[model samples]
Structure formats: C-alpha cells, structure tokens
Target: MTVQDIRSFNRFYTHLIGALDHGRHLYAPYTLTESRVLYELAHAPRTDVADLRTQLHLDAGYLTRILDKFERDGLVERGPSERDPRRRRIRLTPRGRETAELLDERARQAVGTLLAGVAPEDRPRLAEALRTVRALLSGGRVPRPEDVVLRAPAPGDLGWIVQRNAALYAAEYGWNAEYEALVARIVADYAQDHDPRRERVWIAELDGRPVGCVMCVRDTAPGAARLRLLLVEPDARGLGIGDRLVAAVVAFAREAGCREVVLWTNDVLAAARRIYRRHGFTPVAEKPHRSFGKDLVGQDWRLDLRAASE
Candidate 1:
C-alpha cells in the first residue's frame, strides 16, 4: 500500500475521534495526550516518571509539565518510591480518580456512539477486523478462540457468500466464472425456496470479519439435507472452522429429523474432505466430470445422522 493511503486513513481516523482538538475529548479540559497520561497514572501501580516517559514515549519536559499541572490541580500525588527513595512514584488523588472515572465513562460512550452506526449483522465482522488489525500490528500474536463467533447470516451475507466463494475459488483453484454462477444459483435457490426448519447458514467470524461460511439445505432425497458452499477463508484455515461448520450441519440435520446429510466436493479439496471425514461422512460415490472449467473427479459424501440418534 502507498504511504498516501496510510496517511489518508490516519487522517480519517483522527478526524473521526476529534483527536486534534484540545478539551474536545470528554469535554473535560484535558488534551488527549494529557488524558492518556492521567489514565496511565490512575491505573498503573508503582508508576515512576521514567516508566511513564518510556511507556508513553513522551518528552520528559512535557511529562514534567503535565504532572506539574496535575499537582497544582490536586489531582496527583508524588511519593518517594518504597524501594528507592531517589525514585519517585505517582498516584492519583481522590479528585484525580474521580476525573479518571469520568474520562473512562466518556470514552465508553464515545465508542458506543461510534459502533451504533454499524449494522447489527456487521458488528461481529467489524470486531474481528479490529482484532486482526491489532494482531497484525502486535507482531502476529494469535487471538484466543473465545474471541471468535459464528453467527447466522443476515441480509447481505448471502451475497457475500456467493462473491467470496467465487473470488476465493478462482484465485486459489483457477475456477472460472461458471463456478461463481453456480454458487449464485445455489444461494438464490436456497434463499428462495429452502425450508427454514431443515436448512441453515452459518458465518464464521474472527476479529469482526467473515472468515468462513457453510450452508445446510433441504436435499432432493426424501429425508436428507445437502451441505453446500462450505468455505473457510485461506487466512482463517487451520482454526477448525470447517469442522465446526460441518458439525453444525450434522447437528441441525439430526434436530430437523433428517436421516442423513450429504455433500459434494472435488478430490483437490483435501482439507474440506478431512473435515467431512472427521464428522463421520464417508465418500459414497465418485465420477470424473468436466465442470467449473476443469476436468475433475467429483465425489459425494454422506453422513448418517440416523445412526447417531439410534
């Protein structure tokens, strides 16, 4: 990405927060930098000037000035470090703590207002995006599993499924537009006619973005469901999203009184196949077919949920 692009985004973000204005944040007469310093002092245990300077990367003179102002306002207390009398530690006075609490409440309200503009369905994906951004900037720290959420598709998700499936397949497998058309058709049919009781779609989200999707739909067979369009984004693979999606399909099929669930895939989709196998699906049929702009062997797999019920 160009530096201009980065600068543009920085400008947009700073403007969004009114960060350049003094006393704009929480309207508490403190600059954003001063507020940050107050927050650090209020929260940090055994905070010394050196530690604050190092952590905040503030000039010693600027920090000294802020602390001096805080001292004058009776919002901060300076104490000799218990460990070393030469080192001074900082603590917030009661008034300072009260101010900190007010700042904290204002910060929370600001975030709430910002997020209020985001659509409900998009919230999880937005959260996932923020986490990914944090992880990327934090030197590739892995996010915890609890941070991920699988949500039901809403409004625009069906379109996202078709678009992402087509784009990802073409990019990864050289599958052509015909594959996209097929996905579009499948999604359209599912949207138009599927029985809600027997079918469901799941979007696997990480860091506020859609990382994967799977759909279980009513099948042509009398008592079977078809698991279709199972896709986990390349970046989100190895996170067991595929397995969880398949498991959800199986569980839903059982709950819907379906005897079995089936899926079709190509031999080249080894990771997907492995997930299917782990979920007790067995390859039942295979045939060579010219499809999706490729000569490939298509395989059908079936999972018997009836036996599980028995």
Candidate 2:
C-alpha cells in the first residue's frame, strides 16, 4: 500500500473513532488521552510513572501534566515507588476505579452497537482483520503468553461456539448449513446434558474477548473423552492458542481418569491437526466422506494417556 493509502485509512479511522467515542471518550468527563491513561491503570492497578509513560508512548512533560490534573481532581494518587525509591508510582483512587469501570462498560456497549449493524456471519472476518491491522502496524509485537486466557464457558459462550464455528466454516471453507446444524446439535447436547466432572468447555480470550474455544465431553465409549470444536481466531493464530486449548483438554482428560482422548476432524484443518500431533494424537481411523458441501476425508485421532498408548 502507498503512503496516500495509509493516510486515507487514518483519516477514515479518525472519523470512525470520533463517532464511536462521542461524549468525550465514551461519555466521561476526561479527554481521550486522559481516558486512555485511566484505561491503562485500570488494567494494571499500580504502575511506575515512567513505565506508564513508556507504555503509552506519550511525551514525559505531557504525561506529567495529565497526572497532575488527575491528582488535583482526586482521581489518582502519586507516591514513592515501593519497588524503587527513586521512582514514582501511580494508583487510581476508589472513585477513579469506578470511573474506569464505567468507561469499560460504555466502551463495550458502544462497540456492541457498532457490531450490531454488521452481519453475524461477517463479524469474525472483521475482528480478524482489525487484529491484523493492529499487529502489523505495531511492528509485529508478539503477545505474551499471559495475554491469552482459558476459562470455563460463561453464559452465551456455548451459543458463540456454535455461531463462530458455523460462520467461520461457511465463510472460509464454503461449508453449508448442515455444518451449522451439526455444531448446534453438539453444543445443545453439551448444554443440556453435561457432567461437570467429566465434561468441560474452555473459551480462550484475548484482550477480554472470546477468540478461540474447545471442549472435552465424555464419549459414548467408556474410558475416553472426546475433544470437540477446537478453533483459534485467524489473527490470534501465532499465539499458540490452539495448542493451549488442546493442552487444557489433555490435562482435564487425564485428571478425569480417562484412559485416552479422541477427536474427529477433517483433513483440511491442517493447523489443528498439527497441534493434535504435537500432543501425541495419532490418526486411528480415516474414511472418505461427502459432507458439509464438500468431498472430504474425515479422520479420527486418539491420544492415549497411558504410556503405551502414546
């Protein structure tokens, strides 16, 4: 892309941001930069002033002025750093935390409304594209391992699992509604009849948004857990999220006293297959099939917790 192209995008994005952040940074009294400082502090409770300035890449003098204003308004407090007596530490007051929470809620709602205008099938593609832009423009900074979180599925997550699986497959692979139906059935079964001890679903979150997911449900056969619906967002791929999800399933399966873990997947999903192989899953069976609006070869993979099984 040319410089003019980049500039054009910047202009468009600036107006889009201005509209999204109406009422002075999502209806708060603070300016955009001040709201950003609060947001950083809200995520990282107490931080050194120098570190904060570096993280935001703001001019030292300007940041100091913002901090001064914040302190005068009683939103933040400055103190000698406990870690280093030579430096200053910044902490938000209780009121400041409340304001930060409000900002977060408002930002979520604003983004939700923006997304509501988009077709449901296109959100994943749009989300991935946005992340790609950030990653590229940020000098390809690698996200830390801690940035990806794996937690038990919360309300609405099961539905998300089905929807994302359906939308992503249909968009990327030209799969049909039958695929979505299958995902819906699988998720509904888990939702209606799942034992906490023997079955679990994990949602992978990045930047507080769901980006990937997997599940381990009790297979019809005894002594085996079935791994299902392993997926990582396209832009989130290099962060090893897919591997992490599979690893979680293995850990849970072993802890649940399952002799082995198994999964069914198509040959086209090479990335997921690689992760499974890395975790010692071997293809146990394969067959040609006509399904999901495609001619495909489906494979059954097994990971034996028993030493010999591996």
Q: Which candidate leads the pack in lDDT? A: 2
Scored by lDDT, model 2 comes in at 0.84
State candidate 2's TM-score: 0.56
> Estimated TM-score per prediction?
0.58, 0.56
| Local accuracy of candidate 2 as per-residue lDDT tens digits, 108-136 | 77877788889999988997898888778
lDDT of 1 by residue, 282-303 (tens): 9999999998899999999998
Can you tell me which runs of candidate 2 are displaced by over 4 Å? 1-142, 308-310
Displacement of residue 156 (Cα, Å) in model 2 is: 1.3
